[model samples]
Target: MTVPHRLSRRTFVGGALLGASALTGCSTVSRSTDVAAINKPAELPVYRRWKGAEPDLPTVNPLVPDAYLRYPRTTERAYSRKPGDGSEVKGSVAINTPIPPPPDRNRYWQELNARTNLNLGLTITPHADHTDKFQTQVAGDALGDIWTIPDRTPYLPQLLEAKAQDLTPYLSGRAILKYPFLASIPTDSWRGCVFSGRIFALPVPRGALSALALLVRADLFRERGVDPEFSTVDELMSVARSMSDDRNNRWAFASVPTSILCTMMGISNDWAEHGGKLTYFKETEEWLEVLDISRRMVREKLAHPDGITSYNGKAWFQSGAVSMMQDTYSALAGLYQQAKGDFEIGLPIVPGPDGAPAKPWYLNPNNAITGVSRAAPERIEMLLDFLNWCSAPIGTDEYTFRKYGIEGIHHTVKDGDPRMTAVGNSETGLGDFPIQYLTESPKPLYLPGFPDGTKEMYRNLKAVTPGMKPGPVHGLYSPTSSKKGELLGKFIDDTTNDVLLGRAKVSAWPETVRRWRRRGGDAMRAEYEQALEVKAG
Candidate 1:
């Protein structure tokens, strides 16, 4: 399945995520955020790993997912009974994959309903169309029994506070331990669900798995005799220059490596967190330096000559037109498949200017979060049970069924691993119907029939996650950010792009940033800083 952009601010925490202990110590220094008047850490779910199939490989970093070389031949029953109420359940969720076969004609859908004892119906919104669909519904107050809330929706915190159920009473602390699969989700992931001091949704955990990484061509590095171990930005750029050849119409980058450059420069993940204060990255001198470096890369032909216009960076990376591109760790599977033995991919950690291990900006630790609209306690409980059942981890009969579909009809084991059958390719899959977006287990480092890729991904995550940091303002509400939303966001984005593309002088940045601050950036910063001061637990 296609992944949404990793660095996009659009990736969101649940409207309100976590108690004090829920968020891991990253850039944010707000344990008090989870205290009473803000939230209660005791209200959060206790983390308990699901006892499932043993992994063939080890994951030292807790953020890195366990890797499996072979699919578990057997699955244990996670629950003894169906989670649904034998009644129709309707919901809406966004999908990045192609629309799957509809429930009426799909065997997998028919079986899922029978197994769950619910007539499940969902209006699947394509990622491209989701914003409009979600907003239209939100405006009309017509949210279904369940829905996936977009991170960028206008006044998200208010909408959730007004229309969504407070999941804290159900999922908080030891209370969550009853839902084995939900408890299995890392506690930090639940931090994304906290809004206004209460849990409002169930997060879709991606954690460090979704962090953006620099994908370099290892074969080319060896062939060109370029050293792959560089600890500073200048050293890395030297290598980039050595790897590029304008005369041959080749560059070291497919597109402007903005995200990678920002990481290397130690720019904070949107907002920099310091002693009881939060500073937006746009207000910093370091971000401007990154913009200048990006512009220089364009002028020196280190990046593609098209000047950052819409172009396929992955296509360039695959075709050898570019030696490096930035993508999430999840991209390796597709890259390996497309390469067809043509190249070896490398995951190199970029170091900061001071040679410190640069902190990669972690996505919200979740994608969209699933929220339940106001409903009877029984209906809500049933929905939660259904979600917890959906979270059945790898090596459970439910995970196997929901993730891959029925064995013979959808997938088959071949050469010691599961492979999708031709029928599985067209009639069923997550891209076609994104039930997983509602809530699924944290993804394992598993790619059917690509064991090496799985191993490599694990190594990659291990290499970088120790230095990764999350955006401090992620779950904190900023009324200015919500009210103005992307309208105000577009101004800053356009200004930043103009400077990066060399259309505007680097000196213009200060004025542009000032304009941003004057418009709403300053207010957002104030709001977030205030949020950090409030206690949660």
Candidate 2:
């Protein structure tokens, strides 16, 4: 089915309004660009001009606004009636599934559909295995109007380049800014969606404070009289050595492979600055010191003997065998819920060789940007409207009921906090309800069964976590990501992993850098440079 490329100006204008609504009330605005016009309320005359198919103006002014300029309404119409009843506004939408919904049945898709005003029929696809599925569908012209393409996949750049609707107009204005919680999304998350100054995706902003941290057993630390707050790597190692008793079926700290360790230590594979260059980790002594310390930790037996074999680091922490491991803060809630004893989980800011706290690794800001398919243009407005609604803060009672389910059915409020009880269970043994995944409001610090002081413990952990220095690859989004950059990405990942794991020595890093440059890295750099040039213009 060869889809016709209409290139209709109205479609482009309408899509622009929809995209703009998604970002309207978001918290962080990009200072890098001039978005003044987008920050204001929609002028009514402009709305009248762009309203559906009727041109009120005699001639289209290049600068004049249209009906598409109206404040975006919520798209919750789909949830107004039962699925397949067709009582709501009757537009069909294709979306990616299994779709995430509020745990409560009453407010789930019903709220989503009512806000978006569309019947969203989802096409089930896994994020990991969707590349070929997406390609085949797009090539066949069988794509849904709204689908989520994973940010991690290689196919995103290509999809955007192939005439996908540019969402820049929609995202730039007051329509999106009206929703207060929607305003909280960070601009960095939207950077990946911008190409040639046009936006194509609605970014799902991961919170700014995300970072990898060490999770340790509070029970074990208390028993051993260890303070659990080590000022230096040496102090941490000292505790690990004393606590590790692998012979008695205990290990002080579970060993993480080199790549994660290096990231925790802040060793980026490449660094760029001043719009001119790229540098490798081999050029820095800090990189070598991090590796040397890690190798010694393994040799000294402070880490698990089978550390290399223990790939599931979370499971190690969960089983109570490995007392300490590193992971993101998102894991904190689950780990606290699952651990048997009253244990505290703390995030020690990774320490440098000088025993001073080092900067935590900052992930690429665009980590969670999402794209909608071009197959269904009408669906775009609905999708963005629903997203904006979801980003709003819920009342405390509403938040608990929506996230945990009814008080007696799925959970019980104990001591003024909701506790997980009987209702549903999955293969993971815990119920499928996810209280922590809500992006609308900042997650509450309380959870049932955690020690009374756990909230304070988390506050203290965050207080100690170090700030991030700008990444070497900061502000660089690859435009050549269209060409051979996919191969280059794989090489970088593979070579970096090899060097970190000690499978390839530090001496091999320079050659690895050269190999990467030879295999499209240089070209990709050039592409980004060009993009920056255009953006500057």
Candidate 3:
């Protein structure tokens, strides 16, 4: 249920402002004129203390998580053997869901290859064209000893010093005390799999509430009486023009909410800092007031002209045409299991304007990382023993058959939790063929039997985590933002979607922030302000 982090396919085709400029080019950077980053800030690794399972709420704040309300009646198997060595591994990832059941007619991939004797294979792919098939398999080095290194990969420390696998001599410092579930991760998610200083990839933790938001539908805003709270931006454009109609085709917005109007104009998630200097949210002014409020949500039609060429705005908000959109609050529990809950999706209240101060945009703890292929380097201890049985934890048994795959043929438990059986939803694709993409265990917010939809998505991400901000070069590393920051973020998302569809103007946003600071956002803010003064010495 909520230990998913399964967000790839550029977390829904790079929306939320192109995934906040690919998390500000994977956590801020420096030393450009041809890449250079790790001159410090790598000495991280040091987590390895196990003994897990005890949840039902008690994680308090490592930035809020541990919530679970069911499932864990009694379990405890952190690894007594079974990591693979019976030969035949192979991998690939990328997912985005819907394509499971293959590993040779998957019976949870043949009971996780006979409980780790091995013979896996995989390949997966499809996260909306997995970065052109992961850059044609990392430019033909043909990766696959375990893959998925996406953090908007481009030059990523010269593709981890040429095709991954440095894993700092088997998980650095105390050599990760011999893989007790990849040393139970959590050393601040191994600083996003460190690069220039070495650990070359493993983490995927991620948090600080980022499964993007805005969602809404709240039973059609309480049956159109409207007023699901608003405070400005002209009262949410007068509640999206009284929930627009477009001659009854319905269109209260299926896009152009541009990450909730850049959190109602507080905008600062991709590099924020003030007195000490650092700017970058497209050289802010609340990003030119969210490009003049996305050209007034497309000249007041209140959006949804296929929301500027759709890529599943939750299928135009589940065919009601559009009551609102801005996704990934973990695809709201499979769109509430394809609306068996008939309505109510939620996440509004992002208003702000009168006294101004809404903000919301903090995510970037670690998501998407799993390397290990530098041409096999002697299969790095069988890919760290299959990533220590895919970092088990979360009430184990190899995380309940690598995440719900065979109990009465792929899930059934019921009151003690489990669920997913309609032939395990036509065979393993819920949250796309799990094993939590390559390696997991350190993300928790449970949703088992939907504890009130996990307390209304963690009380709406803890009422926007006290105006979240997070990103002053998040984990730092900016070889010109891993080489031309996604081609200068698709040239600033095709010139801000051509000035929000008026086909360009708003004085083309300060010359598109002066061509994204003369291309490379002013040498990635002078290489993240000297990697934030060597991370404050």
Number of the top TM-score candidate: 1
Give candidate 2's total backbone clashes.
Answer: 37
Instruction: Provide the TM-score for each candidate, comma-separated.
Output: 0.88, 0.68, 0.34
Candidate 2, 307-345: lDDT as tens digits: 654355667777777788765555576776666655666
lDDT tens per residue, model 1, 430-452? 32347788998988887766676
* Higher-TM-score candidate of 2 and 3: 2
Error of 2 at 444 (Å): 5.6
Question: How does each model score on lDDT?
Answer: 0.73, 0.46, 0.67
lDDT computed for candidate 2: 0.46
Off by over 4 Å in 3: 1-83, 86-110, 113-115, 118-191, 205-211, 225-232, 237-262, 273-328, 334-340, 344-362, 365-379, 388-404, 411-419, 422-472, 477-528, 532-537
TM-score, cand. 1 vs. native: 0.88
List model 3 lDDT by residue over 1-537, tens digit each: 001123221112222222232323433332233223463556666676566777766554455566677877548666677767788867787776777767666576777788888887878877777767776776566766888765565545545555566778777777777777777676756766675667778866655545456777878888888975677778888888898888888888787767667667666566677755788666777777778877887887787776765545787787778888876565676776677455767676575454444555554556577787764555688668777777777777777776677788778888888887866765667734645777777666676666776677677666555635456666666555655666776678777887777887876588888878987688867876776676667
Which 10-residue window in model 3 sums to the lowest lDDT?
A: 1-10
Give candidates' CA RMSD values in order: 6.2, 13.1, 18.8
Against the hidden true structure, what lDDT does model 3 obtain?
Answer: 0.67
Ranking of all candidate structures by their lDDT, best first: 1, 3, 2
